[model samples]
Each structure stands twice: as C-alpha cells, then as structure tokens.
Target: MRHYDLVILGTGSGNMLLDEEFDHLRTAIVEPDRFGGTCLNRGCIPSKMFVITADAVEDARSAARLGVHAHVDPVEWKAVRDRIFNHIDPLHDSAVNYRREKGVDVYIDEGHFVAPKVLEVKGEQITADTFVVAVGSRPVVPGTPGLDSVNYHTSDTIMRIDELPASMVVIGGGFIAAEFSHVFSAFGTCVTILQRGPRLLTAEDEQVSARFTELAAQRNRVLLNATVTSVEPHGDGVSVTVACPDGTHVIEAASLLVCVGRRPNTDRLDAAAGGLELDEHGHIVTDSAYRTSVPGVWALGDAVNHFQLKHMANAESRLVRHNILHPEDVRTLTNRVTPHAVFTNPQIASVGLTEQEARRREMDYLVNVRNYAATAYGWALEDTTSFAKILASPADRTILGAHIIGPQAATLIQPLIQAMALGSTVDQVASGVLYIHPALTEVVEQALLAL
Candidate 1:
C-alpha cells in the first residue's frame, strides 16, 4: 500500500485547490477521465463557446428588424466543433503535465474507497492522512425502455457530432436543453424539447418561466407535461415515444439529446466504505466548515453541494482548501445568495430568493417588473419580451431576489448579485450607483427603482 499526506480524487475544481502553499505535503490526484472536469471538458466552457456562435447567427437572423438585412452562408458544423474543441481539448493535457511538473503524482484512473481513509486507484491501495473528494456529477440517464439499443447523445457527446442534424429531439427542460436547442436551431436544425413539467426552467420564478416558455415555444417545438415512455432505433437516429398533455405520439429526428438532470458521484466512489455520510440524494454530507462526517476525509464541489453548478463547485473548492489547511480557523461559505445564469435565447440570470420562496415563508415583500421595451437600448434592439423582476422586503426595502431575461441578462445580474451578497437595500442598489444611459442595464435599474 502506498501512503501520502493527501490524495485528491477527481480533478475539476480540486485541481485549482492546489498552489505553492501546499508544497510541504505529499499530494497525489486520481482522475477517471480527462484532467479537466465537466466544465472544461464538456459543460460550461465549450457550451458557452457554441452559444456565442449561436448568438451571432441569431443576431444575423434578427437583423431585419433593425433595418439591416444580414445572412450567414455555409454554417459549417465540423469547423465550429473542431475550433472549439481544438482550443479546449489541449488544456486537459496541460493540466496533467502541470501537476506532474509540480512534483504531484497524477493517476489518470478512477479511485474508490476500500477502507477508512484509503482509496484504491487502478488496483493500487493508496492511503492518505487527508482526502479531498471533488468527483463531479454526470448527466442522468433514466431507464426509459429500449434506450440503450439506440445511439443517443448527452451534453457530453452532443457537441462533437460530426454533422449538425436536420432535426433534434431534446429530452429535458433545464439549462442544458435550452442552450443546446438554441445552438442547433440557430444553425438550422429543427429542435424539439420534451419537458415533463408545465413550464421550462421550473427552477426559475414562475413569471419568468412562463415568459420563457412562451418565447421558447415560438422558437422550437416545446412539449410540456411530457414523459418519454420508450425509445427505439428507427431510421438513422431514434424514435421517441412521448406521452404529453395533448396525447401519445412518436417523434422521429436525426438526433436525440437527453439532459434530464445530474446526480452526485458519491455512490460510485463507494463512500460508505470510507464511513462518509451521504444524504438521501447521494450527496456527501458536510458541515459548515466543509468537513465530512469522517475526521480525515473531506469533500466539496458536486460530491457535497446540491447546487451542482460549476461556479458553486468552484466556490466550495476554495473553502474546502482553506478548511483543510487552517483546520483551527475555517471559513464558512459567506456568499449564501449565489447567482446563476442560463445562456439561451433571451438569456436568463437570477440571484437570491425567488418570490415564491418569500411567499411560502410568509414574509412581507414587494415585487416590481420592468420590461426591456421600456429602456432606450431595448428600443434600439426592438426587444419586447425581455424583462427584469425584483423582489424586496416591504418593511426596509432590502433586495431579496432578482431575475432577468433578455440579452446580457447574465452580465446585468452581476451587480444585483453583488448587492445581495453585500446585504444592500433596494434604494442603495437602485440609487447609489449610476446606470449608464441607453444601456441594457437600465432595465435592472428601472426594476429596482420601481420596487
């Protein structure tokens, strides 16, 4: 059995946890796949790159409204795919090389616990005085009948398809489905989304979800209250048997992409053998200090956090690193109001509590919604469906929640996230800072001021 001071499992954000500060301790990293986790290899970075191209295509299509006709010729899927991965795929090799150069042992294989404080990687029994498990989540594959027989793709494999399909049937309503659907549809694929819920992005505020659903329906074939009963190989792709609100039917498309959800990787890690407590949903349980139930074993990122967002995972990683080093003085996650964004048509971004949560808590709150059409920049872009909604405490008018849907929603929500993180009141956020004239941010300013 080989032993070390620390053994970090799964790269992802855990790779970023290492710096010159830990030079004294003997460290090793075990990864089952590529060095970069989902974000670099599959999720955030590559998807956003695709979205930027999709956004450009969409802008060119919508240019006629601005009295400037534009056209995109010869949309090359292979070139776009190669360009994005050409830039991204090399970074995985660099991460491995960088760690090796730093005198850290890098094992490019999966590791699982065989005993307390011990993890076995590629048949090697390695024990560590301390363990940091940052193994991330994977795309959920539900047991829809005959699913395995056909060739299908998840977010992990869809981006690399040799050619853009004539049509695609997406089987989820979350951010992944929204983003990819926008990408392919903008590139001329007939996209259809199958959502089991009544509205897409059910996690968003109800009003925002309803508006997004309305907008998305206009762009693609969106089936709500849908359930996939079965799937089988038809022609080139798969035939999806869907039971939706309307009736039972079959959909034939050139591609099928499943993005139902994701679950933490604790089960695969055999965490029980290591005496780690996992929640009902298989997420590793951790205290405020980011320590697991086991004394010498710690976990962060998707292994512990239910947020399951790359940014959230990155934040947890920073705290876990500190807690591991400074055991006596560990920092808790201070930014409770973590913000998130969905990069799709009329992009969506949100921070803090939703209005439903406030109402459920029976708190006195005020709500204000300002549409993009009311802003000067909105008029310039001829935007009508985008808006920003703000919720605040009625008593002191402290900002409680903010949701935005429109171009640059992700960027506009940053100031609101900062305000909420700093516990700034509505008036302080609305009036304290000056919003530049004719900017899209004026929609946020208008919403907060109206609140």
Candidate 2:
C-alpha cells in the first residue's frame, strides 16, 4: 500500500490542482482515459473544430442571399477526423508525460474508493490525506429494445467514425444532437432528429427554443414529440422504430447517433465505498466549497456537477483548490452564474432564468426581444429568424437572463454573461457601453435598451 499527500481521482478539471504551488506535496492523478478530459478529447474542443468547417459550408450555401454566389465542396471526413485527433492526441500524450516527469504518479487506469480515503487502481491500494474526484460523465444510452445488438454511436464515438455516415437517425434533441446534426448536414449527410420533447433546446428561453426548432426543421427532418421504442441492425445500417403522437414509424439510416444525455461517473467510482453522498442522479453531493459529506474528500467537475460543462468544472476546481489549501480560511464560491451555448446552426446561447421560470416564480421582471432583422448587420446578412431575448429585474434593472439565436450567438452572449456575473443592471451593461456600429453585438444592446 502507498499513500499520497493528494490524489486527484480523475484528470478532467482535477488536472488543474497540481501546479508549482503543490510541488511540496506528494501528488498523484488517476485516469484510464485521455488526460485532458472530455472537453479536449471528444466534447467541446473537437466539436468546435468540426463546427468551423460545417459553418464555412453553411456560409457558402447561404452566400447566394448576399448576392455572392458561392459553392462548397464535399467534406473529407477522414481528413477532418485525422487532422483533429492528430493535434488533440499529441496534446493528451504530452500532458500525461509532463505530469509523470513531474514525479506525479500518473496512473493510466480506472480507480475507485475501496474504503474511506482509500482508492484501488490496477491492483494497487493507495490512500491519500485528501482526495479530489473529477472523473467526468459518459453519454447516456437509453435502453431501446435491441439497441445493444446494433452498432450505434454516442457523442464519444461519433466524431471518430472512419467515414461520414450517408444518412443518420439522431435520437434526442439537446445540444449534442443539434451540434453534430449541423456538422454532418453541412457536410452533405442527411440527418433526421427524433426529439421526445415538443421542441429542441427546451432548457433555453421559450422563444429561442421555438425559433431554433423552426430553423432546424427547415434544415433537417425533425420529428417532434417522438419516442424511440427500439433499434436493430438492418442492412449496412440501423432501423429505428419511433412512436410519434400521430403514429409509429420505422426509419432506416446508415448510422444511429444517440445523444439523450450524460450520467456522472460516480457509479463507477463506487462513491458509497468512500462514504461520499450522491444525489439520485448519481452525482457526488457537494457544498458551495466543493466538499463532500466526508471530511478531507472534496470533488469537482462532472462527477460533482450536473452542469457537465468544462468551464463550470474549471470554476469549481479553482474554488476546491483554495478550500483544500486553506482549510481554516475556506472561502465558498460566490459567483453562481452559469452560462451555456450550443454551437449548432443559428448558434444558441443562454444564461440565467427563462421567462417560464420567472412567470412560474411570479418574479417582477421586464422582458424584451430584438430581432437580427432590426439591425444593420442583420440586413447585411439577410438574417430574419435570429433574435436576442433578455430579462431583467424591474426594481434594480439588473440583467436576470439573456438568450440569443443566430450568427455569433455564442460570442454575442459573452457580454450578457459578464453583466450577470458582475451583477450589473441593464443600464449599466448597455446604456454606458459603446457597441461597434453596424456590428451584430448591437442586437444585444438593443434588447437590453428595450428592457
């Protein structure tokens, strides 16, 4: 048996802990998968790289509307896939090597707690004075009948396929489904989405969800209120049987991509063995300081957060680091504002409460909506369906929430996120700030001004 001053159970955001400051402490990191975590290996970063290419194709397709007729060539799937992994894999290897060279016991194996403060990895039992669990989540695979028998892909495996699927039947309508749909569809692959809900991005403001669903339906075959009952291997592809509100339908496609959601890896960690409390969803329970039920055991990242966002995990990691180092003077995380964006076509981003939530809570809030068509940039791009929706407190005029859909929606939502983080009012965010004339960001300013 060996012991460590600190042992980070997962290498995702947990990787942030071992720095020059922790040099004096004996540290170790355990990870059976990639070192940089989901975001770097298969989630945010690689998806965006694929999106940029998809966006270029989309731009060319829509270029005729700008009076600049343009054409796009077929996307080389292998080349794109190879180029991405070629870059990302080296970085992952380098991280593993760098940490090992630093005398950190980099265990490239899955580990779980066998007893309080003790973990077992590759037949080795190690105890740590303090443990950090950042092992992220994995894609949720719903038990559709015969699904296990057929070959299907999740967000984890879909990006690395050898060839771009000719036609895909996508199950689920969240950000993951929307993103890959945009990528493959832009690359000339046919896409069909099966959403169990009435709309896509149900978490976003109602207007944004409605607008995105409307736009998405135009680009791909979207079956709303769809329930997938079963899947089976058929021919060279898969056959999906869906029960819709109207009737049941059997759809065949070259590939089946499931993007229902993700569940935390806490189950694999055997969190109970460590005396860690977990929610019903298997997420490690934590306080504002990222401390678990057991003392000396702090957790962060997807395992501890249902948000499952890399940026959010990073924020939690920072807080946990401080709390572990200064146990006597522990400071709780204050900034609770979380912002998220989907990099699909007519990109979507949102932060804070949705109007439905405010209405349900009976909060006194003012709301405004500004369409891209109302701005100079919108006219230049001939954008008609995109808009920004903002909500603010009527009393203090503090920006409560903001949602955007359209070009640069991800980029445009940053200022609103900043305003919320700073607790700034609509006037403070928009009234005094100068926006570049004719820029798309003016759309956000317009929405705030209206509020």
Candidate 1 matches the true fold with a TM-score of 0.98
Which regions of candidate 2 are displaced past 4 Å?
Answer: none
Model 1 agreement with the true structure over 247-351: per-residue lDDT tens digits: 998999999999999999888899999899999999999888778999988888888887778888888889889988898898998778878999999799998
- Give model 1's clash tally: 0
The global Cα lDDT (0 to 1) of model 2 is 0.91
RMSD of each: 1.0, 1.0
Ten-residue segment with the worst summed lDDT in candidate 2?
302-311
Pairs with steric clashes in candidate 2 = none
lDDT of each: 0.91, 0.91
